[model samples]
Target chain A: MYERTIDDTVTTFGVSGKLWRDSMIMYDRATESLWSHITGECFRGAHEGAKLAVVPSTQTTWAEWRTHHPGSRILFKPGGKGEGSHYRRYFDDPARFGIHGRGIDDDRLAGKDLVLGVRFGDDRVAYPIAAFGDASVRNDSIAGVPVVLIYMKESEAVHVYERTADEKTVHFEPVIAENGLLMRDRETGSLWNPARGEGIEGPRAGNRLERIPATKIFWFAWQTFYPRSRIGGID
Target chain B: MTGTAVLFTLLLQASAPFERSQEVLMGDTLYSVLPLDAIPAIDEPQFVPVAVADTFLAPTEMIIGVSIDGDDRAYSAWQLDEHEIVNDVVGGVPIAVTW
Candidate 1:
């Protein structure tokens, strides 16, 4: 979720055994500073003012990932150490908030509701997981930059892309074709596959939409860090 | 200081009843939960081929997928829930895959 390189040097991180707003805090072995796992920013220690660069990632079903990246390497714990989960019970309880019993201060949505958050250049928005319903694609802008959000409900995947191509901003609508096409641009009628953002079969065939970094997270966690993040596309 | 100024304004507009003082995050805000590396990070991660992974990974289980500079990886949520972090080099870029 974050680039570990700092000042042209690679930094190794550890579980600091600390919690900030009920989230894990990682410590860099190089400086021993505690950094937020969610925000990637140092909150204490030698590197107090430093922050790690966020790397874009996707969250999806294992089957979907395998289908897309069959050659991809899978990270497994050595010798069966990673079999069980510590937070499985926590995940099952929608009423649970965090380590402490702190309730949500902002009632716009529930504390544990998952959301897809996108942030860049002074703009941040939290799209509730419930908003996607089944499969949905919508066009919107953040900080005045055109973008589209595509949610594949079955795969539990969400992707955001800048809908501009060849110096032109194009509006797109979701395609419900039986053959599994995802989007259609109003400008050129190019059908696009939201998963990869590539124009499938149309005037813009071979064109790809620039992907925007987004994260899937708990609403409480996202709100705790980005307290002012805008809530959109939620009922 | 533009980032700070913007953060200040955002904090002022925060709807949460909790007062998020930036000063506190630098002070007493962090609660020490356990000892250092109580939840150890996966340092030298080993990878399994898709065929090997399919035998264990559930079709419905969620995985964090990353593709950078032609190097693709899949980190299962189940493993991440336990380890919390995986420090790996992908496509010459060092990345920490944290849950």
Candidate 2:
């Protein structure tokens, strides 16, 4: 869900086959430090307390990604036999999946409901997928900073961007274009692609919206790590 | 070799067993979460380039798309599911793609 670059070196990482609070722990080879996959922070080893830099990334379907980045390269298993998914059953019935330990329960949302969580400074906000029903753009603010959350149903991808550009506040509304859902700024009518976070046309052309790193994860998992996070729809 | 030389070599090997200091300062007990090398981390992963249309991945498959310095790349979750780690370079930036 995040780029894996630690310090100046792009350290290689591997799954430690370990879990802390039901989250995956990754180990970097360069320093042998253990990191939480969700937080991307080194919790153990010589690089303890070191954090990997956050790179804005999108989790989208292959078709949607290909539509935008046709020339992009994709990873393929060298000798993969097409075994489907190891988490197929887990995804099918996420609610029934038992989580170990106790004192980590939060019934704010269904344990399996998917949420796009963003953290700015000490403020954390979670936007449930259900809140965006048919709308692709949700203009809102986090910690008093104007932000826009964009959701695409076709690929089930979500992106968050700062709504301010050139010291001016900008609001975005969803417009169904030939390609897919495109955002139009209310101020200058500039069209923006939510996926790329760039203004494609109009007065704001060449302007890029700053993206906030977010994670698309289950509500329970998000809450477990970020108990103080605000649920967008709830409060 | 001579018996005396062979005995000395054996003693040297016995004295220098392959052991790394297990001291770790983190709160969590060392190896308490999982033993070292339990999942076998990928040191250096292999990457092959192919046309986007020939990726052979399902349309709904999830990917981690990263664009840095104008060079973009996508790491397939399915492929990462198998190896759990990939060390790659793109646009002069080194990155580790992990599932």
Candidate 3:
């Protein structure tokens, strides 16, 4: 039972019309992604094809979402037999964090907005901005465990771990640049460079070694209290 | 007979200080948290039930010293005051108490 104060209007790629769920309410931050009993279509709740997006910060009223979307269309009807018709079933689905209802005037979302853009002037660079769960819930088989997913300016989704544990994945894409290298331990400022013969340790010790050129580098490592889950998945 | 007398004298020597409290000692029983010689024992939750105050008294201090599931650490008590029992699943474990 985690409590979070939400105050931003979440804008999405395929959503339109007045924002039904007001942003100024305190909601349980559960289910990071939009989900649906429907197969193909998606919504703001935890479901496939639906990604976490930032809510708009400043706005006098809920009608402002119309201005952001402009040409976006929303299908209010129920889901059809198959294909795109399933999209309509998501109309009334609650947002992943238990945010719902209307007529609640909230001031917190009055100006909180999410800024999406390409980083380092590269079109290939897509900074993951939103994720529903963090690491604690990611590795667990349980459906929900305070998921702590995160998105960086130029990386994929990540799970946030509560405590460093055994067999848990500590996923991070460390970017190393020319004249500067990515460090494994951020606090200690340790550099990871293949050209400099900085040997990789732990699970992926003898795998395909890449040189950490002083450019953009992204590397991932999993932290486990016990070293049971080896590379290529636990047997 | 001489060995028996010596043993009696040793018992008398050892029981001198506990003699007065020996009446109260009838109700008290020593409980060991771990087996006779278990290594790498946990020092937390320093309470264990060796005897029942009454026949209806259930064992409340039952805690796992170590893993029963390869490397999982858990306690029989919910520890709900600490609020850590929200999203865990134990299939066939016995339930002494539910917070």
Candidate 4:
């Protein structure tokens, strides 16, 4: 098993170009209006050094989820259509877990843990880990959509077991090079994008394009927002 | 209606002038719901002071404390020494104060 403590706490902020708006009122720094389209069930805090609450997705209606995770911020794909519904797909909801109709492929990942990191937009990225009882992720396009599978092994390395994003299929082997996570192709030895295509290099294939350090990613996002303020009142 | 307006205008003139002060404090309490009349538009990116007091604010392990008095009032005290609870990389409106 990959025995490592992953810092699951993440703080993601909107990119510079992305607009931040509150639907409750007109945009005014003084009034501190509520957000118009922010959704997803996650805990958010408002202190300069406040530990933000990371609300895990609970399988319930969006309204119920918001009651528990009021301050959670939702992340959208870069250049994505500003859709408000269907946030439950990405956000976790205990009630809706198995209801999505996607069952876990336990047989494929018989004895490994899969750790994956995703980079979205400029300063928004997250690393969510899920264990498969005994399943394997195949390197194939699912319904013509690209996806990557991470599998853990008892003795072998935990790796990007499969890559099937952007309509291309590629297999990757995880190697311990430079004491960091690296993905190399099993067949052509070409670098691969964990999501769609082969990356630039095998040893550190997705380092440049993706695979950013989780710590640096957090630091960059936290720095973008002004420290949480306690504005006494709005005039 | 005219009498009510005259009374309100008289009350406003009788009160002291409202002078605005800005400070950047480290805290996690949600102070956004304060009445709008108390706080006006603050200049974005202002480097206000962050302070904590013993009775008003207390610093515990990695977390600062702001006390809510019996009257349901919020107050704080700043630590004389400047300590960073959160890194300065996040640069939006930093306005958290804990007592």
Candidate 5:
């Protein structure tokens, strides 16, 4: 997700049907500039060198999201047939599609493994979904910035946050409560909804964790762009 | 140089290196590359506001939820699979949802 504006002009974008490094390229109607969907940067045309601001988002099941946000709205195509996922076959057996030609040289993880990738400056870290399994929270640092990564099985959503609040560093542990899995900060014992990045209970109630924008994507696609990214859960 | 010329020069300086031929630009080998406009990007997709309960999608279906300011909205992956893009506004923020 990206804010579609270039030089104060609010623009609308569409798929250019172009691919760069196995990612979709977008083009703006205002300038016809081509943008990399992954990086949100324009690579061609009059608006080349422009970049769209990244917005933090989550990819999860409808049931989980609806349960958490009862009043939230959903996207749908009226009178449209539910053909199911277009990439279901590709996701089930990624190797069959061979989207990445000749395969990736790095064998750190399988090409099709899903990962949550976070970047700070030039440093990047990837959390493999397979490693987290169900609900888990990891308090770690990237490029010296203390961060927390939370994974929820029910929603299959990963959220990243800066764990500092009120100038105090907070540590988190995964706890199962009436509301399901939540991150409980050790210092203040505050229960946080990682997806919403909000402190729901304890001394730090009402405080919101600073979200770190991240992407949940395939290892092959991420590695193709961020080859030097560190894999979390690896020594 | 005029202000517009200066801005253009600066933008060009910051832009990524461009290939002389559009073919070379679209000839990436890492993935199965498609011809330019082969998939056809959706330029003007429509979005309507509706209550969550009113939605007809399955419970397991995926959606990309975006919250800007205090407004929150979701873009169905099923719809995106067909259109590939949607330009919409949330809380006065113009956003592009690309699948």
Candidate 6:
């Protein structure tokens, strides 16, 4: 997701039916400049050097989203079929990663391994989704900063958060509660609601972990674009 | 994976839509084989309440959910597969919901 305004003017965008590193290239109606949908960078045209502001958003299942934002509205195409993906075949083909296939020289993970990519400052970390079960949580540190990753089985949405509350660090372990999957911090034995990033029980009640933006990405694409990214769960 | 990201990753790894010609910029393999608007964007998106959406959208269907300043909207994954992008305003911010 990106802000559409470029240099103080709002512009509309369209898919140019083009590719940049096998990623979709978007063009703005105002300048007709081509922009990389992956990086939100203008590659060609009047706004060649410009970029769209990255906006934080979540990708999840309708059921999960509806459960949380019960009153949320959804986009619909009129005079059209409801909703179904056109790339189901390609997505199922683990051997392929793009128009050119997985040509990146990294072998840390398979080309199609789905990962939750967390970016902190200039560095990024990847947590392989397959490493965890349907609903799971993991404690990790990014650049020495304590953090936690929560995976929602139903939605496959990964939520990341800074584990420091009140300048103190805490680690979490997944607990299978009757209601659903949740996290329990090791220090205070506080139960945490992953979706809300808050402490729901024990001594840490009412404490909230700072939310961190994470993107669900394929291993190959993340490697190709960010070679320096370290794969999590590798040890 | 969410439908939007599935579509996006597929776009990144699937075969090129059009024949590739040689071009390079910013360390990326570039191809402008197709003309502009080959896959039109939804400039004026129509939205419906969850009650209305539940009638059509599958429970497991993936969607991009954007919430800002208390205003929330979802872009269907299937809708993005065909259109690729949607220009809309959320939380008073003009934004492009791209695949």
Task: Tell me the lDDT of model 6 at A73.
Answer: 88
Candidate 3 CAPRI level:
incorrect
| lDDT (tens digit, per residue) of candidate 3 on A1-235 | 1101122332111111111111001111233332111111234444444322221111111133223333322211122122232211212222211011122122211111121111111111111222212221112111222111222222221222221213332222344455433323233233333222242554443332221111111111010111121111110
Candidate 6, residues A1-235, lDDT tens digits: the string is 8899999999999877665544567889998898877667787899887878977778778899999998898997777653233343344466765543447568889876888887777668888888877548888788788888888774455688999977988878888888667899888788999877988999988988898767667787777767888888722
- Once fitted onto the true fold, the runs of candidate 5 whose alpha carbons sit more than 4 angstroms away are A83-112, A116-216, A219-233, B1-32, B35-55
Model with the higher DockQ, candidate 1 or 2 = 1
By DockQ, who's the top model here?
A: 6
Report the first chain's TM-score for all candidates. 0.61, 0.63, 0.20, 0.25, 0.62, 0.61
User: Compared to the true structure, candidate 2 yields what TM-score?
Assistant: 0.51
Ordered list by TM-score, greatest first = 6, 1, 5, 2, 4, 3
* Candidate lDDT values, in order: 0.74, 0.65, 0.21, 0.24, 0.65, 0.76
lDDT of 4 by residue, A1-235 (tens): 0101113322222111111111011111222222111121112222222222211112223233233434332211232222232322222232221112232222222111212322222322222233322342323222243334433322111222224423445455555445333356665575543322346664534433222211111111222221221111101
**Per-residue accuracy of model 2 over B1-99 as CA lDDT, tens digit each:** 011111122222333231231233333323233355554544544444436335466677667787778777887664554455566776776666555
4 versus 5: better TM-score goes to: 5
Residues A180-214, model 5: lDDT tens digits: 68889999788888777898888888999888767
The lDDT, on a scale of 0 to 1, for candidate 4 is 0.24
Name the weakest run of 10 consecutive residues (lDDT summed) in model 1 chain B: B1-10
Q: Please report, as a residue range, the 10-residue window in candidate 4 chain B with the lowest summed lDDT.
A: B75-84
For model 2 chain A, the run of ten residues with the poorest summed lDDT = A95-104
Q: Residue A106 CA error for candidate 3 (Å)?
A: 3.5
Where model 3 places Cα greater than 4 Å from the true spot, the runs are A1-104, A111-149, A154-158, A166-235, B1-99
Q: Candidate 3, chain A: TM-score? A: 0.20
Give candidate 6's fnat, 2 decimals.
0.77
For model 3, what is the alpha-carbon lDDT of residue B32? 17
The root-mean-square deviation over C-alpha atoms between each candidate and the true structure, in angstroms, is 9.7, 13.4, 29.1, 21.6, 10.8, 9.1
